[model samples]
Target: MTSTKTSLLGLTRAELESFAVALGEPSYRGRQLYLWIYGRRARSFEEMTDLPEPLRRRLDAAASLDRLSLVRDTTAPDGARKLLLEMSDGLRIESVYLPDSPGNTVCISSQVGCALGCAFCATGKMGFYRNLTAGEIVDQVIEVERLTGARLTNVVLMGMGEPLHNYDNVVKALHLLSDPKGIAISRSRITVSTVGITPMIERWCSDDPPAKLAISLHATTDERRASIMPVARAYPLDDLMKSLRRLAHVTRYHVTFEYIMIAGLNDRREDATNLKTLLRNIPVKVNLIRLHPTGSDLQPSSDNAIARFLDWLRQEGIRCTLRESRGVENSAACGMLFAQEPIRPSSTQRRTLDTDD
Candidate 1:
């Protein structure tokens, strides 16, 4: 059951200290709470062995270490696991855990659903529900790590929502996730995928973004792009490219462009040439992604078409990789996350907590 107390999951060390001080405890108690909550991954105050019994009770009364409830767990044949997590309001979001050799990666959602309405994405079809608090976003990583019993080496904000749309919360989540006193995951290990929000990209670059930026550039031209991704209509291709070029100049990291190959939509020889020209001066690595089934009429690009596109990019001195679809059988791949069976909440008002609050 969801707790009414303030959630401690998303609070930073300083914020946690402040919270402790508010409860008539020493500021160091907050540091202890940070270690217990993030380092020890404690689910309840009772599990905080170092904390005094009375203090534990006091913490339990004022703060909650709440986590999203795992509603459904599905694993694809390729060993990728999809987790459907239910929020306090019963709105569910999906996260994907891709287990690999030396490291594991979890793709987490930043919103209950997406508003972008991308033609090939399943999440976009659900329409926008609400923006996930920083706590909700961070918990997806903690919960996935707990459920899988595998330490996550990488985190991707590429699961269900357009992360940039929920800018404040997403940035807050990034701070908490990369804090050395807590999860301590390096900034380089994190990747945020956006559908090219030009203003957000420029802002993120100016602020010295922690994680690498990946732009979803499925089509070469603005007309074809806007046809598939509605957000493209607001921030056109030219403006988006200008931002990326600026980003290339500022950040040392290579900006990866994710191009989804649909059957006959944007997988032509002309498209490849245009794409090369568009990304001519930008420092980018292109990932030619095969279309994952989203229960839409759209189909994946032909293998020959994918090969030709790859060849064209390589011939033009562009760095490109052909990413074959993974976890497709169970709809756990890219563009396939949709919480089909979300539980409805009761009449009680849902409580949301954040560090800034």
Candidate 2:
């Protein structure tokens, strides 16, 4: 298996320049190659027509550029499209492109499967597989651009796995996504969500952080949260809130809280009140997501229940929005991204790696 370090597509402009100089090519060659892959969105070396044939041959021989392949694509009635991407290693992941009034938004996955074990999520049930390389993540966005012929304005790292778990690669992907020479998408257009990984959040706030942060805050009470997301057992509500406070204070961005309304679970009026009390001092917006049926024990909150919950939050003066479910018919809604292929465990199973580095 060749490592990504040998791949040219994933390299930053500076890294590409260094590689080109090491190969005794002019510095301009690296910039040309960067523009070819990112600006021109070329897939194969042959497509880089501006580069001389000899240089293209040298580049191809030194490093391979091919990364992700679009295995399947499904469009929703609402015009949302979901893609099943097969990585070079044959590991599968999902990415979604949603058409909004402003522009299209692409939801990219950071890991193959999830290890968080959130009870309501289907990806969690699939177990952790492998972390996706930065190239793989960037390739999904490029593929979407190629298909739509329109620039993707917004990106949300809320797909199969928790992005904060795959911190380094996720951050690298963000940098590549926001690079001025490439996609040049503003950091504000990218939103990275996590299931409250405190240490990583703290580091992200202190270090170079992305534009927005969203926490998967399903429950207000620690006990209730622990029952649903196993991650809560490690970082409880109080601890998580402290970290969130630091993030908000440092970044000055109102964090978004994602609350999935499960019927007979956390949809009660009292739950709304508890949520308000819990988020009283934090700068936050609550996104109430209607639970998409994943054929699990969980059920979607009734329309009445969701309306009542939203009304309660409004009465309490909390900013809340009820997110409309998209692509439910295609299993592309929240908590529904898992490979449809049969799981065939390898003879030697790789140890599951934590995404929280």
Candidate 3:
């Protein structure tokens, strides 16, 4: 029978110390347990060979190492892998890993489902379920690390849900990852992307560690932005830009701007010029992303159209890069992290996708 004890995955070093004290053990035992669980990647108290048998048995009966249960694992031909992780409460989330020369990058979700309802996102269409606990978020990295048999160098909280919406848990997860006794990933390596939550971004700018920030600024104007990203109605583009400027000064990190081009909608020379003016004062690197076809009426901007926009930005002296599309085969690319089968694209949609380079 499995133990009904509390999960050890959520406890911090101090909390672990307290647990050790409660277990009638020395304070150092908590530190040892912390290292064993996160540092050495022990999945059970019995796996901790350093501890005494009785104490290990006691911990075994009192605390659980049970974390996320792997549900479905799919890999794209390009080597991008997406994992569907099941939380203790049966809520499911998706985490994707993208490989590059530097190291592996894990894109982890913060919520079960998303409420943002961005017109192009599959996860958003699933509707909001619940926010994931801090332990749930941290366990994703641990499980992914264990599965891949290698260290994950970079992490981005831009998977299935709006991370800033689940502020506290996401922040807690950040600290947990930075814990030297645990995952020990550098602050600079983690990127927390948001769809422009003003208050949260301001709070992050002031209080949070120096994690790289990225804003999903798909549209240059407020009217157009609000159509796709409903959050724009709550936090207008003007206000969001102000917070981003403050963020640039506070973090001194060049914020990355993610812009997905939809043909005939946000793809135009004028849009690029407007985007340039909007981010002119902010220290940012613009990433031009091709929209992943998701059975939506929206068409990704053509390759020529993307080139034209990049050219316009370059002419305007803005730092930018047209991001290469990844994981299109297994449907693990950006905005494609869905637990359910996506709606089939129409015949017209298929033709448009086939033309994409």
Clashing pairs in 1: none
| 209-243 per-residue lDDT for model 1 (tens digits) | 57889999999888899888867778878888899
Write one digit per residue (lDDT tens) for candidate 2, span 1-357: 754436876778888888889989888888888888787788888899988899878777777887687788998898778888887777788888898835789988988888888888888877788788888888889988787676899988989888877788888888888887887778988998899888888889888655599999988788788888877878878778888888888888898999999887788888988887788678989999988877678778889999999999999899999987888888888888888865455614434655333
Question: lDDT score, residue 223, model 3?
Answer: 88
The prediction achieving the highest lDDT against the true structure is 1
> Could you tell me which 10 consecutive residues in candidate 3 have the lowest summed lDDT?
348-357
Residue pairs with backbone overlap in model 3: none
In candidate 2, which residue pairs get closer than 3 Å at backbone N, Cα or C atoms, i.e. clash? Answer: 165-355
Runs off by more than 4 Å, candidate 2: 1-5, 342-357
**Could you tally the backbone clashes for each prediction?**
0, 1, 0
What TM-score, computed on C-alpha atoms, does each candidate reach? Answer: 0.94, 0.94, 0.92
Candidate RMSDs in Å, in order, are 4.0, 2.2, 6.6
Regarding lDDT, does 1 or 2 come out ahead?
1
lDDT of each: 0.86, 0.83, 0.83
